[model samples]
Target chain A: MIRALFPVLAILAVWVLLADGALACAVCSGGDDDVKVKDSYVAATIFMSLLPLCVVGGGFLFLRHRYRATPDE
Target chain B: MTSRTTSLRVVTNPRPPVVPSAVLGMLLFLFTELMLFAGLISAHSIARAGALLGWPPPGQPRLPLEETALNTAALLLSGALLIVAQRVFARDKRRTKPWLTASIALGAFFVIFQGVEWVGLIREGLTLTSSTHGGFFYLIIGIHALHAVAALIVLGMNWLRLHRGILAQSTFAAGQVFWYFVVGVWPILYWRVYG
Candidate 1:
């Protein structure tokens, strides 16, 4: 089951990374925050970013269910 | 040339349409907008860090956060109302006009609030060239503002169909998808900008 879910998880990860990568850089606008980008290895949190992805991906899946998914062939 | 019955059968097929391409199209358009915002964020971040100029190129003013936040709230509320409108229309036609009217009114109000905020902000000394923050403010909120205007116009047209009793439930679903996106994406921008 875990292996089968990998593709969906991967797609979902890419979705979040693509979005959160931009936002991570986006929120730091104060000129003197002293954010070290190039040399520092920061441990990013799944809690902050991944939660949003799960919700968005799940929203899309719900929409697909409500509107697109159909019965019969 | 005379196969109306067969065409009807095809239209009335037992299986429902997948709408995969349409879903993909929406996602792609959203991705493009993300790229646009990403570019703005990158420019702003680098400049803020002194990697580039101190932004605004020396002629712009800081944005008035107090007023813009009000407009942000307006837009957020409009989205909530739109969902309400869609839900109302999903069941019965009689309830459609009320919800549609509420949605349309809220959307128009949101746009008007944005306009008023922009005009007031500019008068108070903020401009696209005021400073890095000023430029970022204008570019980020301005793009979203433009999208808001376009969405209101589209919703108005869609509203006309609903008022005239010509729209289908499925079509409402289509419009709602885009509307939700417009509403859904704003908080992220608002938080970043206002912060």
Candidate 2:
């Protein structure tokens, strides 16, 4: 699971990049632009570490909740 | 005293089932979805605040805020109907169809209104590529609409099951959870898109 979700976090890392890098796009513009978005690497690192755990944990809770109750009433 | 027989499918459980598990599942799904959108909205909020340009960009018309507000009303009404449907279904499954149908209708109306408003916004000159405002508006609303679509499918399934027979309360409850998700997501969209 860790191996599989690593890429998603990496991609998110790139998104946070926009928070810091690249000032002007005066010359041209387009989709996904491949522009490095600007953000502190520290913040992105924290997010990458945090979000997937949240996703996995939430799914676990949901599944467990579905089975926890008695079927009747 | 009464005795119970065990079923071969153990996961299905040999004992009588608990209260509606589906309700919790739906609620769980809603919470997960809220987190997902919350992430996006948070990013957008931070980015918008930092933008050299105010949202809506230099020339873009301010959002069709009033139109979107009306759409918000449609979703809120749908939520109410779902609550009513859950109540009726719990007491007597036979008559859930009307409330369920009303909930479904309101759900459909919300989506239709969103689509119309999108078209109007485009006619007024907003496109995903046009500006960051346009980008966030389209992406956020589009994703929320997808959730709404999924919620409708859950409703449809529940509706079908009700017609066929009294579905397990867990299943109906699960459906309600999803319905609430559809309703819960709207206000976040409305505030960011218009406010």
Candidate 3:
């Protein structure tokens, strides 16, 4: 298992090291003094990223529960 | 020999679905629709944030916050009535008609009121091409309106089926899910756009 995880761990370490390089685009970065714009970008990014996962994950969990509750024919 | 024969027999019955296919299909569709709205709302947020002169821009006519609030109440009440109708349906499907009719009427009222509001806004120089504020307003709210109309149509059809004594539970459930989505998403839009 450790050997199998070695590449995955290495990739994660590299990703962490290079994280700051993944900066926002010019439009998203907005004006340096405009806190509201920066905040909105962050909020919107988080919302867009998490919404699908929440919805799809919730749906999956509900279905799984229902399926488990159902009696076997 | 009897035990051996029983073991060899094939099981013909399949496990039933956790959710009805119709309801499941509607849920899946709503998921995609939810994502679409999310994207639009996200874009609107970013645009509003980037507006140097502040949201609604300097010269754009203000959104009808009060009037639209009333309309929002009407839409919410319609959703509530639908839940009531569903409950009534469980007892006596026939008894659900009045509640269902009321729900549909309120929903229709919402749409009509929105249309009137749109006309007023357009006359006030909030046309689609006038400004970014106007554009986002129309685009986000217009897409929502389209969804509302479509959901209302679905509910209307289900109501008719109920009237004709042919409505299935699954069908009504599916329509309910869609109508709820339309109703549920509105408050968020109102807050993000109008508030």
In order, what DockQ does each candidate have? 0.15, 0.10, 0.57
Off by over 4 Å in 3: A1-33, A69-71, B1-16
**Model 3 per-residue lDDT tens digits across residues B47-81:** 88778787788778999999999999999999999
Residue A3 in model 1: lDDT: 100
Q: Candidate 2's residue-wise lDDT over B45-140, tens digit each? A: 545655655666789978877777787888898899889988898798888899999989989998888888889889988999888888888898
Lowest lDDT sum, 10 consecutive residues, model 1 chain B, at B48-57
Ten residues in a row with the worst lDDT in model 2 chain B? Answer: B10-19
lDDT of 1 by residue, B1-195 (tens): 675554434545555555645555665576567556655654554555443444434555555567767766776777788788877777777677776677767777877877787888789788777655777787887888787777677677778888789876666665666677778778777665665
**Top TM-score: which candidate number?**
3
lDDT head-to-head 1 vs 3, winner:
3
- Show the lowest summed lDDT stretch of 10 residues, model 3 chain B: B1-10
Q: Order the numbered candidates by TM-score, best leading.
A: 3, 2, 1
| Per-model TM-score versus the true fold | 0.66, 0.67, 0.87
Q: What is the lDDT of residue B68 in candidate 2?
A: 74
Would you list the clashing residue pairs of candidate 1?
B55-B132, B56-B131, B56-B132, B60-B130
Question: Which candidate number would show the highest lDDT if scored against the true structure?
Answer: 3
Clash count in backbone of candidate 3: 0
What stretches of model 2 exceed 4 Å from their correct place?
A1-73, B1-31
